[model samples]
Target: MEEVQTQRESEQETSDESAQSDQDDNQPIVSPPTQPEPSYPSERLKRAAHMLFFKRGRVPGAKAWELKAGIGKSYEKVLDQLDEELKELDLQVKKVEAGGIGEYSPEDDEADKFRYFVRLRGTLTPKEARMSGWRIDNLAALAAALSLVVSKQGKVERKELEIMIAEKAGRWRTLTLTDTFLRTGYLEEDETGMISLGWRTKAEVDLPSLMMLVAEAKPQDDDAEAPATSSMEESVPQPSEEQSTE
Candidate 1:
């Protein structure tokens, strides 16, 4: 009877241990939460500076004053922060000296030409402004017009070009064929009213490879019915077995 009781006690202990192991396996695992993304103040200031410089074309002083009035920061502190960011981006601050400045104005120059009556100043050339890929319609029209001029062998009458472009592309396009070519530096008109490619267009002149290929294929098509080689080939000298033996 004691042996049976001892056996029962051992079995009970084993069952309790198995139950504890099952509970441990069923326990949920808890992990640490992820940290949120950090925002950099310097990066924000750099973006704001670039906007001021390129978009507004304002000097540092004017930009700082605008920022202070608009965003509630002192001009001096904003300027210092802007300067630090500009240094990090490898941009230099240019100071213009003028007599008694209430508001700074760009000086006039004889060489400078206005586009659509807006005066462009400081470092940004007219070509650069046009080439900045900002005007898609202008670029497309320019490309199409220049291509028509080049394909027509360096000179295309303006009216003829307009008709062709209207048929090829569509009506309601903003740029005229002449305006397009003018913008792209491809076509120019003389005083006598003859339109021709400009210097830049002349520089790019070459026989287009596609045109050359088409020209070559034309002769082959014309001669398709003719014999492959000349009849004179039979009269040409050929070494025979008898000649080799001699």
Candidate 2:
């Protein structure tokens, strides 16, 4: 009886061990903890970012010294550091000259300097547009005006644009929309008063995507013909019964 009891106890222990082994096998495996990302730059860099990203009026960006007091320090280094932080989001702070490289004159005491501007890794995607704090209407107007400019192959006559907008939203809205585009640096007026695509359009707006969108746009239905046909019918006096009989 002792031998039989001992064997039973041994078997029970084995079963318990097997059960624990199975529980361990059923448990989920845990991965190692990931390292945290580095922190953003100082308040001055943050301020620069705010101005570059949020301020649409100041295209290309503001002066480095104007951003903060520490002009002597490595401003470029700080901008590069900020760009590294923004890299995760596919954005960067690019240093742009005010009016092209030729415009930079060391001879002049007050010549234009490099300005820091915010740009995406790729073209200005809809995601960037939404993130840039632009209103829906603003974007729509831009798209419309840009489409016209693109269709014209770079420039659209101001008079033609005014007429087009006047037909839809009246003359006042045309002025407002055009002025807004101009102010935002998306449109530039040439000496001839023609509205052309601005420098920022090239910098920010994706030309390829713009062309593709314009190409894929659905054509408006031929409702003009319907209006014309109805007007012609009304203008043609109907034949009277006596005239018809004759």
Candidate 3:
């Protein structure tokens, strides 16, 4: 009777341990956290616009938003707000100039009215335009340095030119200017610190080429410096040594 009682106690203890182990094994596992979904409509619209800008180089049309919105009634109001924001950035709705005899109306009732388009404009001088277009901030200094070299007939003290540019443009660092010059293929520095346009750089670009690029760029109607296409061709730079070698 005592042996049987001891055996029964051991079996009960084993059963409890086995039950606890099974419960532990049955517990669900937790996964790593994920990014939260966007909570606001405007944020979603902005994300959509950014995506469209990167993919197609412009904003999406009203029709596109409608399709994306999937027949949602808020599309018109959302698109209007988006247009207002885009206008602040100098982008506007692309309008068709003329409609055919049976063409669709320009009102919201017509599907064709929402066709999207964008115009890109630059707000800088010809030399400045290149820098601005490429988003290079040290452009003014590089242009000034290049101008100095060209004006002085292809030779300039690097320090003096940098100082001149700083004086003219106000408080730009030497390293930043130097980096810009190198990146843009505009100038080079020697071990003595004297600066000049590199042979390869000089071979590729000259004052005439700069003038031609300026002339070829689309200018505002009121811009006095805008040159004609014929004048632009005339401004083409003479072939450099690299060009001759080729």
Candidate 4:
């Protein structure tokens, strides 16, 4: 009778275990709570803006590698985001060594070799340029210089360029400003004394639009009241801007 009692108790415990197992099987699983993804892009973008807009060290722009280190993986997307943000402010992000980048993705495996900058989306009005401390003679000299270089297939003798700019500006001013451009990275001079567009110019200037504007610019017809249209404004591939009469 004691042996029967032991067997009965063991059977009862087994039945209880089976019921508990069924209960556990029906219970819902509760996983650990997950953390939200961090939004680092906005903060990274601010860093990028400061790097591009402000002069750091000896340069006015930042390199892809520098930006990548500070912005994280595939930082070009952050630049794209910056570009979008800039459009509203009449500015845009540009990358040098990216010829015709508008038609395709300018970023590449060798992107680190390129540099990034911020530039005006629209041509600055004459008043704006002047108020920004731009002398008309200097502006004319620059327009003449870049236009001559572009017309010469992007390579010209240094002396020839100086002479071309001298036609717009005096010889002394030409020498002074040429050095300025060279030091500032707008024009590069090789050992052979050939002048070509520098990395900074490639980053900031639109060669095609510049050339077109120079080619199309002519003296306005003798009708002051005839609504003199600005060829510079028209040639530039942007929205029309009202001309500023100085």
Please, what is the whole-model Cα lDDT of each candidate in the order they appear? 0.51, 0.72, 0.56, 0.79
Candidate 3 structure quality by residue, lDDT tens digits, 175-221: 56666675554676666877776432343344665655545767457
Q: For candidate 2, what is the lDDT?
A: 0.72
Candidate no. 4 TM-score:
0.65
lDDT of 1 at 218: 36
Worst window of 10 by summed lDDT in candidate 1: 110-119
The alpha-carbon lDDT assigned to residue 58 of candidate 1 equals: 21
- Rank by TM-score (best first): 4, 2, 3, 1
**lDDT tens digits by residue: candidate 2, 26-142:** 999999999875444577677657766776554546655555444324566667778887989989776655543223466543423656678887656777768889766667767
Clashing pairs in 3: none
Error of 2 at 205 (Å): 2.3
Q: Give TM-scores for every candidate, taking all chains together and pairing residue i with residue i.
A: 0.27, 0.50, 0.29, 0.65
C-alpha RMSD of candidate 2: 9.7
Best by TM-score: 4
Question: Which runs in model 1 stand beyond 4 Å of their true positions?
Answer: 1-144, 174-177, 204-246
Query: What local lDDT score does residue 98 receive in model 2, on the 0 to 100 scale?
Result: 50
* Alpha-carbon RMSD of each model: 19.8, 9.7, 22.2, 14.0
lDDT of 4 by residue, 73-182 (tens): 76888888888889989999987763322212545457666678899888889899899886878877877888888888889999999988886788778899899788
